[model samples]
Target: MANLESFIRSAEHGSFSEAGRRMSLTPAAVSRNVAMLERNLGVRLFHRSTRRLTLTEAGEAFRVGIAEKLDGIQAAIAEVATGGGEPAGTLKVSLPPSLGLTYILPLLPGLLARHPGIRPEWHFESRPVDLVAEGYDAAIGGGFELSPGVVARALAPAHIIAVASPGYMAGRVRPADPAGLRSLEGVVMRAPRTGRIRRWTMRDAAGQEMPVLLPESVVVNDPVAMREAALLGLGAAMLAVPDALPALESGQLIRLVPRWYADAGAISLYYASRTLVPRKTRVFVDWVTDAFGKQKLAERFAGSLM
Candidate 1:
């Protein structure tokens, strides 16, 4: 069972080193366990190399067959061991770097103070992750395509607003509409997966929508870089609210069209939809929702553009 767990984690991360880090073992130990598993199965599970490690055909099929069952077995054992009391175990989660740091990281200290038994294994991801396939216990972000047995609970509106440094907006006239935004240079973002400049449809409070066609003067794949470029007076940037909110509040970045914003959907907390959710996850979900409501973050995030 330990060998199989090591193999599944190694496969999920594609690196023994990372798997070892997660499992609190050395890379060599993880490698040895995987070797033992392969020997026991009488098949090569991985094609090893100095630069990369890949699962063989038999390994992939084996992982597909046993991964879910292994997880269920682990969960059942954990429930019995803890007696379903104070939830204890490492809770693996995926979160976007910039946004997660801004909004979620600060909430961690409180969560730990309340639930010392729960250990957090948080990974910063710029894109949506496959919760089950990647072995994440939870994921927080927007625009994730729902997979089987996953559910999303929206935390707040993820609004994208055009922003520019005061120096960059100094000499230019404020755009009256999205079309007028073309007069300014834009440090646009390339879609991480598509490798194309992202398009935006700006909407006003009146339910009017307009397509924004900015001349892409500079391109970046990272949201943090996009915000920095705009901060350096390079060009206008369309940034998610959580990414831009700090700067906007500090007068580092100002809204372009205060009345217009893009709706990229809501920043949501996603977890397994199973009825018998782990207590750690249940507590986390409840804590986050309760805190978000008390702080009125949804209203703050939504009313910022207005």
Candidate 2:
């Protein structure tokens, strides 16, 4: 029964050979074990051919049942291992670079204190990821672009704000309003969406929408670097409120204009599925949610301007 279960899971992973490697068994052994189980059950679980191996109706049904059973077993084991105390496991999470450094990294100590046995390994990326295919337990990004069957938790609304260093604006002409942005030299992100230059989209006081395409001098995609440039008097650029807060409070970076608001929408944390959520993913989510509830994070970071 154990071999049969292993074979079924391996098959579901898309390749017999790959499954064998994962289960630490030989491909021939896995094939023979599955074949014996099919013979004993008197049903075809897999339709085998040289070109492809496909699941039979019985096999599909069996897989669905086994997948659920496997998930239950994992959860039971996690519960027992933790002894209803602290969660214990290696948690794998992927996060956007700026958010990970600004938020999660700072809160690591608290999370570790709560679940001393659990260790979280985070991937700070500027690109999207496939949770199941990449073997990630969870992912945090500015937006939820994941396919259906994935679960999402809203972390916070990521507000993009336009700011510039005090030194940069000291002697130069600052944009008096949204219309004056045309004359200001701006530093924007260099990416596929940004092309040759970037535009800072803002809303006026009268609820009017505008896209301000200012003059470009510096273009870089790294958010942290952009924040540094803005602090060092590079030029006016749009940044996430959280990333800009420290500089704003320290008077390193100041709001570009009171009328223009750069809004990039919300940020969220997503996982492949709740049905098979690992203990590590659950504990991390719980910790972040608790942190969000207690902190005036946005306001504290944005300073008095926001």
For each candidate in turn, the TM-score is 0.80, 0.72
Those runs of model 2 whose alpha carbons end farther than 4 Å from true positions after fitting are 1-85, 192-196, 298-305
* Model 2: colliding residue pairs: 245-301
Per-residue lDDT of candidate 1, residues 1-306 (tens digit):
568767977988899998888666799999999999999999999999987789999999998887667657555544664687987667888999987788788889999999898889899989999987777788999989899888999999999889999999997899988888899998999998999899999988999999998899999999999999999999998998889888989999998888899999899999987646777788888888888899878887883444
Q: Number of the top candidate by lDDT?
A: 1
Candidate whose TM-score is highest:
1
Residues 1-306, candidate 2, lDDT per residue (tens digit)? 445644555566756676566445687877887888888888888887765578889888877777746545555555655666667665778988777887888889988887787767789987778776666778887655767557778767666777888878888887776667667667778765445454567775577777777666788877787888787787888888888876777888888776667666667778766454556678788888778768966444432236
Reference-based lDDT, each prediction: 0.86, 0.71
